[model samples]
Target chain A: MSVLSLISGASIPVQLVMAILLLASLFSWYYIFLKVFTLRRAEKQTAEFERQFWSGADLTDLFQRAVNARDSAGSLERIFESGFREFTKHRREPGTDVGALMDSTRRAMRATYQREMDKLESSLSFLASVGSVSPYVGLLGTVWGIMNSFRGLANVGQATLSHVAPGIAEALIATAIGLFAAIPAVVAYNRFAGDVNRLAIRFDSFTEEFSNILQRQVH
Target chain B: MAAAAIHSRDEALAGGLALAMHVLFLVLLVFGVSWQHKQADTAVIVDLWRDLPSVTPPRVEPPPPPPEVKPEPPKPVPKVEAKPPPKPEPAPVVKPDIALKEKQDRERKLKEQQEAAEKKKLAAEKAREAELEKKKRAEAEALKQKQAAEAEAKRVAAEQQKARDALAAQQAAAQAKVVDEYKRQISAKIRRFIVLPPNVSDAAQVEFEITVLPGGEVLGAKLRRAANSTPAYDAAVERAILRAQPLPLPPDPALMRQFRELNLVFRPKD
Candidate 1:
C-alpha cells in the first residue's frame, strides 16, 4: 500500500466538525455578501430620499406614497405615517384640544422611530455570536482531539515521534479551522454593527428635523 | 404644530433604520459563507488522514530460489574379493559281481574247510561281506535325509526374504504421503488468513503484531503503523483489526504450534 492512502482515511467526528465549521463559514460569508448589497442600496435610498425631501417636491404626494405604497417609503416615511396619521385624526375630532393632538402625534412618531431602530438591529446579534464564539468552538474540538491522542498513548509501552505526531497534528487542525471560521465573521460583525449604529443616529436626527417640518405645516 | 414636525422626523428615522437592517443581514451572510469555506477545507484534511496509510502488505513476486548446485559423483573404489578353489569330485564305488557257478563251488569248499584251519578265515570273510552290505544300506538312507532337509531350508529362506521386502516398501510410501499432506494443509491455511481491504485505490499497509493461541483464538493486536493519527483514520484501522478476529489456524496439531505469535499486514485492495 502507498503512504498516501493511509493518511486520508477520515473518521466521522472530524468530518462532522469540518462540515459544521464549513456551514457556519458559508452562512457568515453569505450574510456578508447579502449585507454588502443591502447596505449599499439602503445608503443610496437614504441619499435619494434626503435629496428629494430637501427639494421642492410636493409633501402630499410623498405622504400618500408613504401611507399607500410603503415599498417606496423609507424609515423617514414610516415615521411620517405614524405622526401624520395621528395629527389628521386629531384635527378631524370635535372638541379635541390642539396641545393634546401635537403631544400624542409626537409621542407616536417617537415610538415608531424606536421600533425601526430595533428592526435594524435584528440578526446583528447573531453575527456577533458567530464572530465571538467560533474560534473557541474550534479550540474545543482541537483540545478534545489532543486529549484522545494522549489517552491512547498511555497504553503504548514506548511512544515514538511518529506515534504522537499524527495525533497532535490532527488536533491542531481543529484549532486552525476554528480560527479560520471566526476571523472574518468578527471583522464583518464589527464593521456592519457600527454602520447600523451610525445609520440609527441619522434616523434619530432626521425624525427631529421632520418633526420641525411638520410643525411648520400645522402652523 | 409640534406633532406635524415630529411626524416628518419620525418618518426619516424609520427610513434610515430600514436601510441599516438590510445592510446588517447582508453582512451576516458574507461572514457565514467565509466560515463555510474554511470548514470545507478542514473536512478535506480529515479525509487525508484516513486515506494516507493503507494497512496491507503489498503483494510482490517471491524472490527467485537460489541457483541449484550439481554435485560431482564420488570416484569408484575397487573391491578385492578372492575366488576360492573348486572342491574335487567324489569317486564312484564299484559293486562286486555275484556269479552262480562260482557261488556253488565256493559254498562247497567253505563247507569242507568249515572245521579245518582255513575255516576261521572263511568265516571272517563272510562276516566282513555281511557288514559291508549293512553299511551300504545305511549310507543310502542318510543321503535321502540330507536332500529333504536342504529342500525345507530353501523354502524357509525364500519366505523370510519376501516379507522383509514388502515391509520396507510400505513404510517408505506411507511416510512420503504423510509428509506431503501435512505440507499442503499448512500452505492453504496461511494463504487463507490474509485479508484484503475494502477499497484498494487509497488502501495502505497497516502492519500489526498479533498474538494467537493454539486454539486459533486471537489474543492481542498491536498497531505497528498509523497512516496518520487523525481520529478518523486511526479509529477505523483499530476497529478493522478487532473485527478480523479468530485468525486462521493450521489443520494439523503439530503445525498449529508454529503460529503462536506472528506479524500480519493488512492492505485494502479491491
Candidate 2:
C-alpha cells in the first residue's frame, strides 16, 4: 500500500494535522535512536574515567591535569576539575576556614552537576511532548477519518457492514498509528526520566563524598 | 564506602543520559502531527435558491382596513363523481416454460453430441493405429525376405550356410510387434481404468488440481474453489476419481513425462 496515498485520501485539515503528528513521531524516534547511542558513549566514557581514577593514579596529578585541561573539559572531568580547583583556591587564601572551603568546592561541583544534568536532559522535554500529544494527534486523524466515513455512508444507497468496513478500517488505522507512535514515546520518556534521576542522585552523592575527602585532608 | 559511592555515580550518569534523550524523543513525537494529506478534502454544498423562480409570488396584494363586500348565495354543492375501479394490470406475459426446457435440452443434446464425437474419434484413432500396425508387419516381412535373399547369396559364395540373418530378421519383427502391442494395450488399459466423476459430466466445465507421485497413481485431487463444485453432483465426480487410481503408465516417453503430475479441465465434452 502507498502510505502517502493512504494518508492523503483522508480529510484535508486532518491530513495536515496527521502529517505534523507523523513528522513529530519520526523526529522523536530518530532522536530516540540518537540519544541511545549518545548515552551509551557517555556511559562508556564515565566508566573509563572511573576505572582510571582507581587505577593507582596519583590524585594530585589527576587533579592538576583535569584543572589544567580547562579548554576541553569532559562532563565527568569538568566536575572533578571544579571541585579540585575550589579546594586548591580555598587552601591558598589566608585563614580560609577548612569547612567553608569544602563548602565552596561542593557548590562548584553542584553547579557543574546541574550543567551536566541539563545537557543530559536536553531534548527530553520533546520526548515528553511527543508522548503527551501523539495520541491527541492520532485522535484528531481518527475523528477526521470517522467523519469521512460517515459522509461516505450518507452517499451510499445502502449502508452494510461490508460497505462501511473499508472506511472504518482506514479510520481505525489512524488511532492505531497514533498508539504505535505514542507507546514507544511514553515508555522511552519514562525510562529516560528514571535514568536521569538516578544519575542526579549519583552526582549529589558524589559531591557529598568528595566534600568529605576534602574535609579530612584539610583538617 | 567511597568506592561504592563513586561507582554509583558512574551508573547514574549513564542511565541519566539515556533517560533524558529518550524523554526528549517522546516529547517531540507526541506533539508532531502530520498524517492526512490536505488535498483530499472534497466537501461541497450547492444552494438551490438560484436554480428556479417562484411561480406564484409576483402580485403582492395589500390587506384592506375594513371588510366592504356582502355576499348571500345559497347554492347546492355539485354532486361528487363516482370513483372508477382501478384497472387490473394485464397479467405479465409469461413465456412458456419451454424456453428454459429448450435451453436445457439444447445443452443436453450438445453434450451428448460431443461425447459421441469423442467416442467416435477414439474409435477411429484406434482403427487407424490397427491399420498402421498391419502395414508395419507387412513391411517387416518384406525386409525379412530381402535379408534372407542377401544371406543366401553371400552363403553360397562363401560356402558357409548361416541361419544368423534369418534369426535376426525374425527377432527384429517380433520386437517391433511387441512394442506396438504394448502401446495399444496401455492405451486400452488407460481408457478402462479412468472413471471420471459423474458430476464432472462430459458437459461439466471446471479446473482441477491433482498431485501425483512418480507412479501414474493419483496422489490427491481438489477443487481450488466453490465455483468448481457442482453441488451433490461433485460426489459422483469424486467417486470416479477415486475409482481411477493407479492409472496404467504408458511406455511412450512423451506421455510418461507429463503423466507424473497433471491438471486438466474439460468443458461440456472435449
| Count of clashes in candidate 1 | 89
Candidate 2's displacement at residue A119, Å, is 0.5
lDDT of 1 by residue, A23-60 (tens): 67666665665565555555666677778778967777
lDDT tens digits, residue span A86-194, model 2: 8888899999987688778988998998898898887888988888888888887788778888888899898899766666656666776677677777888888878
- Which 10-residue span in candidate 1 chain B carries the lowest summed lDDT? B46-55
TM-scores, each model vs. reference: 0.44, 0.43
Candidate 1 chain A has its poorest 10 consecutive residues by lDDT at A1-10
Number of the top candidate by TM-score?
1
- Residue A141 of model 1 has an lDDT of 67
Looking at model 2 chain A, report the run of 10 residues with the lowest lDDT sum. A1-10
Q: Under CAPRI classification, how is model 2 graded?
A: incorrect
DockQ of each: 0.02, 0.03
Candidate 1: segments with Cα more than 4 A from true spot: A1-15, B1-74, B77-270
- Residue-by-residue lDDT tens digits, candidate 1, B76-180: 333323333233233223334646566676667655554454555566667667766766766766667667666666665675566556656555554445434
Q: Write candidate 2's Cα lDDT for B86-200 as tens digits.
A: 3433434446776777667667766776676677667667766776676676677667766766666665544322334555555556545544443344334433534454546
